[model samples]
Target: MSTSATEPEAADLVCQLDNVQGMVDALTSVRWKRHQDAVVELSEHGIVLIVEESRCLQAKVYLQRELFVRYGYSAQGRPRFGVSLGLFVDCLNTFSVPGHSSTIEIQYPGPDMQLLLKSLDSANACIYAEIRTRIPDMVSWDYNFEPAGSTPLSFTVKSSALKEAIDDLEWPGSSIQITLQPVPPSVTFRGDGHGNLQIDFKYYVNTDLLVAFHCDHQVSYRYKYKFLHATTSNIPASVIKDNRGSKLTIGRGGMLKVQHLVSVARPSISHSHVDSAGYQQPSRIAYIEFFVKPEEDEATGNDS
Candidate 1:
């Protein structure tokens, strides 16, 4: 069977692998951080957005909430709320690997988890991302997802038994889900009529950025955050003495790279494009991108 993680042929071989069930190691992971209501103050020169997040989420992994207002395309120009999005922005280090037989932890990166939160923190979002254990394709069954909580998520499956070679009694595979509760209160921002954000990176953001969070424009608001950014220069002073006091070391495989990126002009369209034959040329493309670094556990631990 194919055992490589980066090979194309591995797909066909991994399909034959066995179906598995899972139990949660911990479920009290999700947390809430802060919420900011945006407002606009018109001045003599220009208009500004006002955004204020709760102090709890300033530097912690907490929940964030924002209101996304959409204008329907019907003749009446009806306004509607698509989906109220919620996400756990931090606190992943508390999560433990599922068990001895699990390989999911060693397969993906922590940034994927963070990136997924940004995507899902929207209503009818353009993108939805999650860092879950992907089941092998050789199995025909849908992913077996169960919340660590008491509620059961339901879905329907249909397959031909008599009309096909396989029988209905056959089972394929099962996956796992760890239902979590938000730790801090979720952070929220709202838009007036324009549901877009503009991003700009600054060396220093004024302590009073809560105003920008309340934007009435068709652009993204501005905010400042701290991240661990160093390509190879961020190696920690000491190596793994133990788990109780290690943040993450660089080039060692466990270290996560934090880049200083300004997410500007997201969920927006530029008006400075060439349009011909009813096709509007795109002046700029807006989308947030994140990368999943390879596992450091691979080179160090045999079964980490």
Candidate 2:
């Protein structure tokens, strides 16, 4: 009897990220202690890391291909796998140095189907890690978030201020109510428990602080404090230091969506592309999004 040899499959995806610390910070933004496992989906455009809590709260980190030094994708379709978020973040952290920068080359579907990561900047030594990944068992939850009403109800505030507001309101109660009105063009956060605390951001007060606002009718919704906190609690200090803006939008059924942009490009390694004017533009960015479900008995105050 003649035996036939088996052929090994090639890696499905390979990419090199020059700004390791930036990627770390972006991933850390969505890293929650409660949900350790995250689903990773790879596509031609980029990679997306998703983490959810009991289908009520969901967070996604988008690592676009433009953010990488080199990107290669040979997969037939979008491939997804589940891996330990804590382990992945911890491993990436080990590759970053505070004052120094490193480039990391990543590959998926290795010989053993494990996710492979290697530090390419080291001169004498090479740091490598192989994290085990499993076939995704649970289907990721997709919340159809449409505009709340005729006009989209949304507001953008400085990241630092948003973080501070959420932190301060924690002492007041277990749930926080968000109220937006068109007449006054203001957004308010109210918490009632042992004490009451209300914080408002008026559109005309300071355009720089409030950034942007849109509300057609009066709308109010209450969300659990823990869920709301999780959205901004883990935001990296670098993001806040950059004076970025965190946008909050209320969708149909009082679904709250929080969005944050994290810069993953360094001044030295970035600037590979030029615009029509021939001016070098900064590298791409990573997007972080969180979706929190409102309380069971969410309040929808006066519509007019």
Best by the TM-score measure: 2
Instruction: Give TM per candidate.
Output: 0.14, 0.90
Candidate 2: the clashing residue pairs are none
- Model 1, poorest ten-residue lDDT window? 16-25
Candidate 1's residue-wise lDDT over 1-304, tens digit each? 2112233222111111010111010101111113322222222222122222232111111110111111111112211111111221122221212232211111111232111211212255322234332222221212222222232211111111111111111222111011111222111211112232212211123212211121111211111111111111211111111001111111121112111111111122344242321122221111111111222222322111
- Which stretch of 10 consecutive residues in model 2 shows the poorest summed lDDT? 1-10
Candidate 1 Cα deviation (angstroms), residue 262 = 28
Off by over 4 Å in 1: 1-30, 33-53, 61-97, 105-304
- How much does candidate 1 score in TM-score? 0.14
